[model samples]
Target: MDQDDSETCQMCPMDEWPNREKTRCLPKLQEFLSYKEDKMASFFCFLVILCCVITCFTLKKFILYWDTPLVKANNRTLSFTVLVSLLLSFLCVFFFLGRPLDITCMLRQTLFGIFFSLAISSLIAKSMMVCIAFKATKPSSSWKKWTGVTLPYSIVVVCSSVQVLICVSWLSTYPPYQGFDMTTYPGKIIIQCNEGSDIWFYSMLGYLGFLAAVSFVLAFMVRTLPDSYNEAKYITFSMLVFCSVWIAMIPAYLSTRGKYMVAVEIFAILTSCAGILSCIFLPKLYILLIKPYLNTRKHVFSWVRK
Candidate 1:
């Protein structure tokens, strides 16, 4: 075709242009409407509160039984074990969510990866703490004193830091998640930190799997410990619940049907709530409230003392 025809093609009538921007400039990245942001923020905020309530109640019970002869008599090393979940819940509430879209995928992924790493590492550290407690009871020897403040925490810091660097590097090198020249939703171009590449997506899966692995080991170690069968059963059940997340999360991330995907995310968060409550909160409640009799010395393991 001649140059005039080509130029005319570009000047095709306004109605003929697919979108106004196709005639002129690059399409703008979509921003979530402030209302949409607020709505999502509010919903997640409520979820945070719900998690906090469950965590705080459990911690309260742990505090109550912490100094009792029953808790100490078990030779538990620390004055508090359940307190960490309470603290993590508070951290999650205060720090996570309502994040700005990072233009630099490097910074964005770094921040996300760091938080993800810390959260999982904290959970794994918890499992290690449980195992150490079990090990302390062995008749053999000096491993008891080995269980203390610094070592497990240090391990967590190291693992989390390593993975944070891994994720940051991946993001720095990839094209930002919006992708190269793809048509996006015009009115609703929401700024989400996408998984930079297949590597990041699968890495997240691997990371969750790793956390589940450690959790399972702890669950196994505690499986046969000489505690009330109910306590043992609850912990095992909770661990199983937690592990199921890794299995479920793959499909959640892969889902691309917009709001359907959001529903999946919501379900995932709800799963977290259930796991935390079942594993950390409700068990403490059973000891402190529902079965307060269990806390009493010389009490028979019966439904009623009648």
Candidate 2:
């Protein structure tokens, strides 16, 4: 008996990919930073949670020692702002872990941008406060007026507001949305958020870098101030770390594709935030908890006289 002749195979639809055996068209494997499937995603989740828990613990310690010289000297209000914004920044990482959706796409970058701006704004405010405090020590210094709470709060509000405005414009003009990339990898589709406007995206990041640079400069200027009011040294170092992480992230983020690109950003967020938290708070926490004597006004005054 004669066997039936083979027929030409038809092309699979764009949404579907062919199996290895070419026996049938199968749904494309959706690629994303999946919390359940990807080990990197799970690790990121663990880090985000760990960072957030540490932030909360630090916040508690600050609140408990709110009246101490160390806390007050650092500007408790600004310290609280930094912690809260940092907590929010860590939470923002969650938006990047799962499958990309419209809401997550809109929130991940903008929310992170705004939160980071808030944190940096607080840092700059702290740095400026140190400068003003130092200048006010001089006879007939006009910086006396800026030593009040108004100037620092104003700095935070104004600096953070600029980032908010940029994010608003980005969302209104061209909001990011979930998109798929079928050609990047054969037999798989990359599910990612399309950054609607590269200009706006980079602008948000650029503004963050600018704020960090300004903070670093201001803090460095007063870093040599007496230890009594020398949180500026910590701020300078933290900004240096923050700037370095993002500067390195840009190239790595650009060079990678799909889920790894997202991983790069998530790693940057965690590392930069950790840098700020550790550089700024660890010393204060040590004083508050381990060396209560150093947290006293007497010790501060002694440092001032030196």
Candidate 3:
């Protein structure tokens, strides 16, 4: 008998396996979307990070101009929070890259869900604030008391808190874990995270969608109001873009497998975030920077009158 035939190869850890000759080891199939291997994922990661940094600069600019009448028209604090959450949402795509460890697997989806929920909730709160403001000016309207930061802040907190609870329950019950998918590709092993429950994942998405739908409806209803006093038109367009991206995402997300699935999601995240940022803030930014004259109360009133 050959000496090599009788001796067993050393046991490999979960990430590696014995080579064909049994004298050395090779890395087992790495399933996660890796920046080192996949150029697409790497490109996306860089793009999202760049967008996040730009958003941060915009955030600082927004803060500097906080006292402007245009910024003061709605809840600035909530707006800031939404921008922060969108930044986080963009950054969260990193978790889906590299190898799928247990902790990263668990966090990638949950954090994405949570951060997006916070952003959507903030949008809904802002839309609601607009509605309340319009209502408060009417005769004997009790909504006058609810016209302050209190209601918008509460809406953000309460809506986001519910999503937090949902994620917690999902994690405690069926946490995601690293898994090998051997059957998807012929003669190749695929490494991926097995999301513990599809139901939980979809539920998280559904909740985010629900909040977005509410915001879209409310903002659309108020879109005809004076654009000077209310940002409902911009909000409506932003929500429309946000909803369209995710709605298109669902079928594509369901249809793709392996790394493409993750890519679809990452793309959706960046697109929706960019949509919100551009649709809602770019016009205001243009007014603030390039056409500063238009930001004045006098210009606003005159435009409205015309």
Candidate 4:
């Protein structure tokens, strides 16, 4: 009932919510992922910075050893491509940490998707190169044509271009935007990005998953080859970890609401990126830094002969 007339009732303004007693309206609370208040967001920010620094360091080391037999053993171009993509993937988490905005909402997922696809495509190219190199060792083999740089470079470009096209299509059509959720929690306005189209969002993820699956299968096929020229085992392990994290993330992301939902995604992105970084690069780093003697061409050929 209204204060002036017992028969009349009044509604609160958009900025105000009803009190528990329904006697008067109070201001609505704003909710979002805040760096100051959200411990998880702050922690994730720290991790992102840490990962970026590590990637830069690794890239520097690879650059210094650019002419070394070890670096040349793997396709230097593809390795650099993977490292750069992984660095960008780590940085992409920032857009999901701050308050939802029109631009951030639109860019966050698409950027992450594109960067991850690039990394996966590079790994697939690496695996293919290893297989072709092994086959080209045979006398008068047809795989000799693919042993050159052209084939792997073409693979990376073609594979990554498909993902770029998907993201462009998604953004041009139904795109994500900032939205408010008032009904989820009383007396609070939960500000979040409303993914404009679930179909497009899932399609983006599905395409990424498809690329990962292809990479994983290709890597697995070449996993039994000698370690000197074969990075397929590492690629297979990384893709396994990457696929598992996102597969689990889908359900958790669907069930959570508000800030927690964002946290789940950030966690998935960081963990999967870390998986790729550590799995593919760590062993190579170990040899480059710790076992320098093993990086020699003689040792590599010895392993190849055995």
Counting clashing residue pairs in each candidate, in order, gives 1, 0, 1, 0
TM-scores across all candidates?
A: 0.63, 0.96, 0.88, 0.96
**Model 3 agreement with the true structure over 1-306: per-residue lDDT tens digits:** 113765654565555566667656566665568878889877997888788887897798789889887776667887898889989998898888887889999999899889988988988888888888778878899999998777788888899888898899889999888888866664346778888998888888888888889888988887777777777788788888888988999999889888888888888888998888888877878888898887776755443454
Regions of candidate 2 where Cα sits further than 4 Å from its true position? 1-7
lDDT per residue as tens, model 4, 1-306:
226435666888776797767777888998888999888889999999999999999999999999898888889989999999999999999999879999999999999989999999999899889888889888999989889899898999999999898889889999999999988887888999998989888988998899899999999999998877778999999999989999999999999999999999999999999999999989989999999999999866565577
Runs in model 4 lying further than 4 Å from the true structure? 1-7
TM-score of 2: 0.96
Q: Give a tens-digit lDDT track for model 1, residues 1-306.
A: 113234454443322223443444333444421325456656666776776676676656666677654454322332243344334534443222443344543353344345545655655565566567556656875778867767667767776777766676666675345322223444334444455677765675467557656656666666664554224444456658766774686576576533334335545545754574666445545666777767665542221232
Q: Candidate 1, residue 208: CA error in Å?
A: 2.8
lDDT of 1: 0.52
Give candidate 3 regions above 4 Å deviation: 1-29, 300-306
Q: What is the lDDT of residue 132 in candidate 2?
A: 85
> All models: lDDT?
0.52, 0.92, 0.82, 0.91
For residue 282, model 2's alpha carbon misses the true position, in angstroms, by 0.6
Predicted structure 4: lDDT: 0.91
